[model samples]
Target: MLPLAAGPPFGPEHTMILEQAATALTLARLTSSPAWDRRAHSSVLLDLLHWRYRSRTEARLRAEALGLPTTGHRLVPVVVDHPGAPSADGVALTDHLASELLSSGVKALVGDLAEGRSGLLLALARASAWQPVVERIARELRAAFGPDVVVAVGPGVTELGQVTRSFREAEEVADAIGPASRDRPFHVASDIGLPELLYSLRDDVRLQKYVEQQLGRLVQHDARHGSDLLDTLRAYLDAAGNKSIAAKHVGLSRQAFYQRLHTIERLLGTDLESGAQRTQLHVAVTALESLGPPAELG
Candidate 1:
């Protein structure tokens, strides 16, 4: 046997090294204080990670660690710094945050809140490039919160801190659209026309009447059947055409679900099976959902 060491089997040398390493890490964490605990207890770090990575692990872990008791239901939280547009300091903060996110591995940025408005925070995702993710995030948020809140998702920015304006614009335009604020979940500068039209429509009792007359039936159908059908379709499309699973979501027999699809197709006069038709129906459904319940078609 080797001669007796100064400490236990590992010896003083190994123990000293391990202790030193722990001490160094602890010091680093302390320096990084308020310790967002990217690995342990998430906070703003979750936003950073979403910018960097496309998941909510830090937030989930932090929430769980705190005994928050969530449904394990994670939202792809799109964070828009409030006052949507960045101030000089805000810009710097966003840059640092963006750098932190890039270092973490985030792929897309979503927001269209106007500058000097609330910042937009989106869930980390890599589906359908930018638009689909924005739409999905918005739709899901609405389904959960029910039109009370409006979320704006900007386009994807390969570079850091570029989406600051997108988030700002999204919110400004959202407020511009007012009553029709939710029309598009993710709004890019290019989508300004829609918001302009939305502003006009807000005051147009006749147009609102037409929308109700034309789409109200479908809206009622969705509410009676499930307010989540739009999300269901989003998921269904995401899964690449699987009706059985979609049927299961709404708790319908495959046959009954098929019937529902037929009803949607008849009312919308569009085919859910085809990509183009699906796209149109998707836009229509989204618009209807955003508009909320219709009043009489007066």
Candidate 2:
């Protein structure tokens, strides 16, 4: 068994913990019960605890709250206390209370990854949850954390006796692809499938080569021009192909935007205005999004 501080299901309790989490999700869905929702939240916390917390006592306390045994597992938890209007003490207290709640199994340990606009922006990147859905979460988080706080959640692994490799992988992807600016934030960790695909590519040279061939020119041009043309393209698509808006966003003049578009057209050997061409470009971009950044082509 792993040390109690190492994480979940090291020896005897693994099966039970997993069962409880699964059951909780099932119960919540089947019964439409808030209690089950609470349990699902607890499971999220449990996963976070296994990834972040450092002490056996801490681990035990968190598991116990979730109605799990602390005998064979540890708690790894990440707590983010935003610096917001209510004061540092408030944030600390909230974090402390949150830790206590996790110890009692009240919520997930992955705190809000971003604050205010940044959090909302990150949510916007998710096509699944539309504006209202993200807006509500953002509003609640803003009220709870206070206006100035920015938070983001990193991926975590909770299963005990497992390699730390996956955990480290999640953290690296989170950090590398996490939004540099809160204003235009995105949590790469939240999109589990994409990062998984990205890391998987490290082992698949053939697929990597294919991606390189498709995006080689764009990658090269970005390097040469010192501009994030890829991001610009994404932003343009996200804005529904509005050059004026794209220019305004990146602080370029309309003429410059047109010039860049021409350059992009020339380099990519595709027409942005054509429906068929735009559709293909969108598909390519989505595929590359899952692949993360491309390697420099020879």
Candidate 3:
């Protein structure tokens, strides 16, 4: 017969370990004075993450504040600005975003409000290789909320202290995209182009007047007759004068498309064949779309 063990299987030993863990937790509570549960703990961590992303002062202190797993830098800040989403507050949006990112195999530290953008800070294996991830994240967020979301990525940095620049760059990108802000959807500091530049000047008085002068008749026509002259003109210009292509897009036959195009030329009293005229019409359509509903215009 084998000798009997000193106690039941893992009885006192397990009990002792549990008691030690409990005591340690109690001591920790005394030290921090708060036993952070799930929601509270998450909120606190997010707050710290926001602080670190916004702070450029001391690297060592920021790292210490962020705790483990984020101690190493090489961080890239991504901002998903969903200003047009009908969500109530920043907290709900941030929570949903954090969950989506985690399920997509990206470990993100989310901050509710950072420079008017929902902050998603993460460290990637390759610092300079984060664009595709940003695009995918934007798509996922748009699916979660709605399509009017813009994602801006900051330049990569080797130190946590340098991440604030990334955050600021992202903010600038979100602001610069303006009308195309909804169209571009994803922005990187280095990728801005003519569309973003033109859209950024949407509030220019002359530009607003130009848009109205060019497209206002089409707008009133659409509203009055329930016709689609504005959409037809936009599609026609978008097709670069390819009547068949524009017709296909607008679901009109070639004859019908030409008739509509002729009508548009007559309505605007400008030749659409000239490249300069085409350019002006296209820009005007874009500006009007950016101005939103006619009610807002009124």
- Native-referenced Cα lDDT, model 2: 0.48
Clash count of each predicted structure: 41, 19, 0
Model 2 weakest 10-residue run by lDDT: 116-125
Off by over 4 Å in 3: 1-59, 68-72, 82-91, 96-109, 114-116, 125-150, 175-207, 251-256, 294-298
Off by over 4 Å in 1: 1-214, 220-241, 294-298
Q: How close is candidate 2 to the true structure, as a TM-score?
A: 0.36
Q: Write the per-residue lDDT of candidate 3 for residues 1-298, one digit (tens) a residue.
A: 9997687577654565565456446444653422232233344334444444323333333233333235444567777776756653443566667666667777556654543457767766653467677777777777767777778778876666555666777777776666445665477877666567556666788877887788777777778888888888989889998889999998999999899888888888989889999998888777776666743443
Note the Cα lDDT for every prediction shown. Answer: 0.46, 0.48, 0.66
Q: Estimate each model's TM-score.
A: 0.31, 0.36, 0.62
Top TM-score model: 3
Residue 115 of model 2 has an lDDT of: 41
Which sequence of candidate numbers ranks them by TM-score, best first?
3, 2, 1
How do the residues 88-198 of candidate 1 rate in per-residue lDDT, one tens digit apiece?
333432343334444544432222223432343433433435455556545544443345445544455432233334434444554544444446555445655543555
